[model samples]
Target: MDIHAWQLWILAAIIAGSLEMALPGFVMLWFCVGAVVASLAAAVGLDINVQLALFTLISVTLFAASRTLFKKAFMRNASTVKTGVEAMVGQEAVVTESLVEGYGGTVRINGELWSARPLGGPVAEGERVIVEQVEGLKLWVRRPAASLEVPLKKKEGR
Candidate 1:
């Protein structure tokens, strides 16, 4: 019984494809196709060097092509994923304690005390602050905008 080079290539192709199925990332599939192409080259009486070259060329071409094609056609990136406390942005919060320079403060948001830091300068305790952003485990807060506040006026008749 005489075994041929193309026969070995065919077996390698099958193994590569099976490995691809077991661990998927679109990675091994191209190599499997390359092995098949190499087998075809062997069948066509091409030299061993040429067949190996064809395998490498075909595998690389397929892998690179698929990377770009799949990324453009299927891959999606979330523009914004506001998870946990980050979703509380723009919500009003009450300062639990006075915020002083060189000292951190706490705010009550969603019935929870959150460590906060003033934006421009420190704010006093019992003041309303807007959550501007979150850094690490602390909240970056600022005084509530006047537009969002109701102005107090003196009544003409009291």
Candidate 2:
């Protein structure tokens, strides 16, 4: 029994499309397109060689076009936002030690000692400050806009 050219093309298209579910992306979409083209060629009474040639050309062109279009759509904007300690902008903390210029100083933030720096004015020990920015492993800090001044203790009557 002889199988028709159109039957072979239709079989190839179904197999290619089914394989795509197991794999990922548009890898098999092009092959399915090629099979359809081959089937069309067979319907027009084209010889087996011409059908094969058309299939090859359509498959390659579709694969290349899909790859280019997918890259532009998915890969161009795939960057993620920084989080955790890297996202501590504008946070407030207290200086656990004095911050001298050009030296690493320690600040207490969220019950942790973090390497810190004075962005402008010197930050004394126990002073409340706000995190201005982050530079490498250190945090640039500044004094808060207002301070919570504690009242002095009163002396007992003589």
Candidate 3:
């Protein structure tokens, strides 16, 4: 039985492709493409050195060229994609329990109760607070700023 160079290249390509599926980042796909190209070169009776050079050149060139495109396409909106606790920031919640100074209480947000600590003075029960930050299982909160409250206007004549 004779083992061929193209067979090894194809195996490498398959392994790289599998790795791309298992990994969390955009890599290994370029190497898989390069391996496939190297296998094609071997099928055309190209020298092993030439096949290796082609594989390295193709992989590196694709990796470098795609980096900027990947960043622009995927990372451009990264800041806008907030999830979990990060999305809780700036959200309004009703205090479920009086939050005493130097003591934490609970608040309800999004129909869920969360441990909350006041950012400044005490927050009374039923008061609306804005989530300022999240630390572990607790949320730092503050009374809604005056700007967020709408002032009632008096009638000119009653």
Candidate 4:
């Protein structure tokens, strides 16, 4: 049983395409395209060196040229969907334990309790604070601006 070079190239293309699907990011797609082009070159009676060279060139060119396009099209939109602790930023949490200045306490956000520290002054228990940043098992929080506003004075004698 004799196997042709083009058949091997097609197999490589299939494997690369499958790998691209299993992995994250747009990494292996260029190699899949390159293998397809190499297979076509082999079908046309091109020399082994020529087929290999074309595969390398096509893959590198597509990877480089499409990098920016892929980043703009795909990576840009991905930032809009944050996961894990990153999503906690800007969310309001009630202080479960009084947070001393420069010290950490507990806060409840999304039904989960988290160790938190104040970004400015200390936060009292039962006060609402906004998550500003997250640092390994701790959240930096600040009081909401509206809570700091002064109330209007009532008119003298009704």
C-alpha lDDT score of every prediction, in listed order: 0.89, 0.87, 0.94, 0.93
Q: What is the lDDT for 127 in model 4? A: 98
Off by over 4 Å in 2: 47-50, 67-80, 83-98, 107-114, 124-158
Off by over 4 Å in 4: 1-48, 59-69, 72-79, 147-158
Span of ten consecutive residues with least summed lDDT in model 1: 72-81
What is candidate 1's CA lDDT for residue 92?
88
Best by TM-score: 1
Q: Write model 2 residue lDDT over 16-95, tens digit each, in one string.
A: 99998889788998999899999999989999999999999999988989977887888997876768777677888889
TM-score of each: 0.63, 0.56, 0.60, 0.55
- Give the Å shift of residue 135 in candidate 1: 4.8
Clashing pairs in 4: none
Please give, for residues 1-158, the per-residue lDDT of candidate 4 as tens digits. Answer: 99999999999999999999999977799999999999999999999999999999999999998978878877985746788888999999999999998778999999999999998898889999999999999999999886566889999999
Against the true structure, candidate 3 reaches a TM-score of 0.60
lDDT of 1 by residue, 59-144 (tens): 99999999787877777662767778768889888999877657778999989999998887889889999999988889889997
Q: Give me the overall lDDT of model 2.
A: 0.87
Clash numbers, per candidate: 0, 0, 0, 0
